[model samples]
Target: MSTLARWLLALFGWKVIYVPPPAPKAVLIFYPHTSNWDFFIGILTRSVVRLPARYAAKDTLFRWPFGWIFAKLGGVPVNRRERTGLVNQLAEEFKRHESFYLVITPEGTRRATSSIKSGFYRLTMLAGVPLGCAFIDYSRREIGVLGYLNLTGNQAEDLTNIVKLYAGRRGKHPTQEGRLVFAAESARSGD
Candidate 1:
């Protein structure tokens, strides 16, 4: 799978850089998710780096035939309809697995937005795991996980560092790329 992913990326003129060692448990925050293609690119990068990561999706996506396929591809379903302790569930998942990488797109959408969702940050703080910064830089034609962030639980300061990691990295659709606003501002503005 890794070989196939590498070949596909190379065939498409995409390059991976600064691959980090797979973490036993961590949150992978992929930035600038400005296109549906970001999902495919992210999957390819995950395989290329040989990371055993599972992405979170609404429980609805785990319904029928596609559910099995997504499961095989490391999709973890969450019931978003209610506050069902998803963070706790994921935290337990980390405790259960010797290795787990939970991939999240804080932008939470393909269209341009004012700010990022705070769930990813809250999840990491609750799970007692480090947050990893991964990016798809369309301008550079590169995709890879840089490394884990040194989070101190201060949302604004920590987010500032995360944003810094993605400095100069543009998305596939630059116009659609959302500005990563702080969680407090996002909440206050009802984004």
Candidate 2:
């Protein structure tokens, strides 16, 4: 799978930059998720780098037969309807796993938005893990894991830094890319 993924990415003129060393637990959040194609690129990159990562998807996709396959591919079912306590559940998963890398799209959707969902930040903080910032720079045809940022438990400051890190990075649809902003409650809560 690694070899095939590498070949396909090379054939398509796409490249992956730094892949960090394996960590016991980390939240890998990618920015500029403006296209559905990002999921395919992310899957291939996961294979190419052989990273042990799990991604959250809507729980509806986990119904019947396909659920097993998705789970095998490290897909975690997220029940968006019951939004509360998801971060705590994910944190528990991290605690149980000796090594876990959870992939997240802070934007929560492909559509344009002004702010990122604070779930990723809250999850990492609860799980006591660093947040890994990955980027898909469409302009450069590159997908790279820029490594992890250790959160200081200050939501506003941490989110601000994360947004700054993604500055200058381009998404496939520039106009649809979300700006990373957090809610005022998140900024004040410090939780």
Candidate 3:
């Protein structure tokens, strides 16, 4: 898998910049998720690093003829409209596995937004795992898990640290870069 990933990355001109955390359990959150291409690139990078991570996507993505492929690739279908306790469910997954990495595109969509969803933060805290800040810096043509940090239970302070990790990284669509704030945070602040 790594060989194929390397070959494909070389063919497409991308550099692998993976730096996974030592901990087996983590919530790997990808920032500036501005393009659908992040999914494919992320999959390739995961293969290159041989990281086993599961990710949640809208339920629609898990439907139809090609849904099996997505599921086979570790995709979890999620219903945004439903009031399911996904965070708790996923936390249980962590407890069930000795090693688990839940990759989350907190923006929840490729479109730009003022803030990201809070599920990633909640999941990390609930599961008692580190948070990995992954990136796909299009400007540098580099992609992979970049940094990991233990949350201090202070949302504001923790967000600052996460932002620092991605200071200079630019997404494929710079204009669509999402903010470091969480949806609930911004909403409470009336942003």
lDDT tens digits, residues 24-95, model 1? Answer: 789988888888788888889888887878898767778996788777888888776788877777888888
Give one digit per residue, the lDDT tens place, for model 2 in 1-191.
99999999899989998758446789989898999898889889888888878899878778897788778888988877765689988999999988888898887878887667889988988898889998899899999797678999987788778878888889999999876777655455553
Better of 1 and 3 by TM-score: 3
Local distance difference test, candidate 1: 0.83
- CA displacement after TM-score superposition, residue 132 of candidate 2 (Å): 0.3
- lDDT at 149 for candidate 1? 79
Model 3 lDDT per residue over 88-186, tens place: 999999999999988888888888888988889889999999999999899999988778999999999999999899989999999898888877788
| Among all candidates shown, the one with the greatest TM-score | 3
Best by lDDT: 3
TM-score computed on alpha carbons, candidate 2: 0.90
RMSD of each: 2.1, 3.3, 1.3
Clashing pairs in 2: none
The clash count of every prediction, one per candidate, is: 0, 0, 0
Ranking by lDDT: 3, 2, 1
What ranking of all candidate models by TM-score puts the best one first?
A: 3, 2, 1
